[model samples]
Target: MTTTTRTAVVTGAARGIGAGVAKRLAADGFAVAVIDLDEAACKPVAEEIEATGGRALAVGVDVADEQGVQAAVDRIAKELGEPTVLVNNAGIIRDNLMFKMTADDWDAVMNVHLRGSFLMTRAVQGYMTKAGWGRIVSLSSTSALGNRGQANYAAAKAGLQGFTKTLAFELGKFGVTANAIAPGFIETEMTAATAERVGMPFEEFKKAAASQIPVARTGRPADIAHAVSFFVSEGAGFVSGQVLYVAGGPKA
Candidate 1:
């Protein structure tokens, strides 16, 4: 009841963590904009929310495209209401050792993770500023802590942390809080792909990963969603500019 019917824009929401965050926000009383690279791909998540009697809208967005991002925000504003919550969750991985990493690989990761977040946030903040209340959450990763063969990804994810803090510094006066969620070992298509890249069965990979964690388990999208749920809640207004490492014990 505290969040009203504020709109929340979650990028890369077609599946995985983005979808989880979008679904959770809708349940938390926000009309969610389920955004991804393909509008059609976004429909299922939006439809699922609507089936649960929550409001949702599907949008296609190339977060790195400035004009496309602006247009997407405008559409979400006109259709679902002005978006007061923004989640920069869209990203891709081009993992390789620095020796074999290409410029294209680096650019692809940076464009989606950094430039995309930059573009989407820039487009949506106006609505938040006008309302004087907002929550901006970006997805960071444990990989940001200097993972091997992930130079580009590590840099991009690390960049999001800085971005979150800066937004907090500049937007706190507007009653907008910014935070980042750095997740570890979440089971998703992306993680599955990582396992495949290493020619390891996902179950075996998960088992190996779980053994390293104090919790002796992997994470799910819903786990990250719960953290996001709290960060965007009315009670979380004072909890900003923090990087929450949701990896079992500490160390991230």
Candidate 2:
């Protein structure tokens, strides 16, 4: 199958890294499903893709809800075609020290990051299996390596790495590849929130972060998107269960 003609489903695609990934995938020629918690939130991204001569369907879905995820996947298959490419990019952060963290905060992050990926993968696996080929990319984070005030977020992100490896092993024989991208210091709304939480100017925060990175630069969402594109390419069939840290340098 031609790469440009394939269908892809990207969760949390309304903005930030998810939006970047969705746009990049569309540029690669896939008919994309722009899925976010609020369907209306996805319109601008979807419309942008369409305006550029790409096919996209805006789907409202709460990836944490099994039923919602199933329905969204079904809709994509019906409207866009069977999705062989799936990006589990939906996530949220509930940052707090372990002692002060609430159960709700922990559950919310786990539900959206880990559970959501699980549900979305399950819903789309059928289409991938039927086609005998697929690409599954989940967003992990440098926080997985361990970060202060991010116990819940760190655990959930780390879990995705394990989940991705298992999928690669289980689905490799079917011409499917599963991988994770652990991004570091990417410029996104999430990071902006982190800066706000810490009472730092966003620009100053990014600059401080860049000073520590070996590349002397903070990452862009597009940088992470490029990594995802590589993993999902037709030529990447033999590469599976790998976690590429797109953090501009080796982890400290």
The local distance difference test score of each candidate is 0.95, 0.94
Query: Could you give me the TM-score of model 1 versus the true structure?
Result: 0.98
- In the range 63-180, model 1's lDDT, one tens digit per residue, is 9998999998999999999999999999999999999999999999999999999998899888989999999999999988999999999999999999999999999999999999
Q: What's each prediction's clash count?
A: 0, 1
Model 2 earns a TM-score of 0.98
The best candidate in terms of lDDT: 1
lDDT of 1: 0.95
Which stretch of 10 consecutive residues in model 2 shows the poorest summed lDDT? 1-10
- Residue pairs in steric clash, candidate 1? none
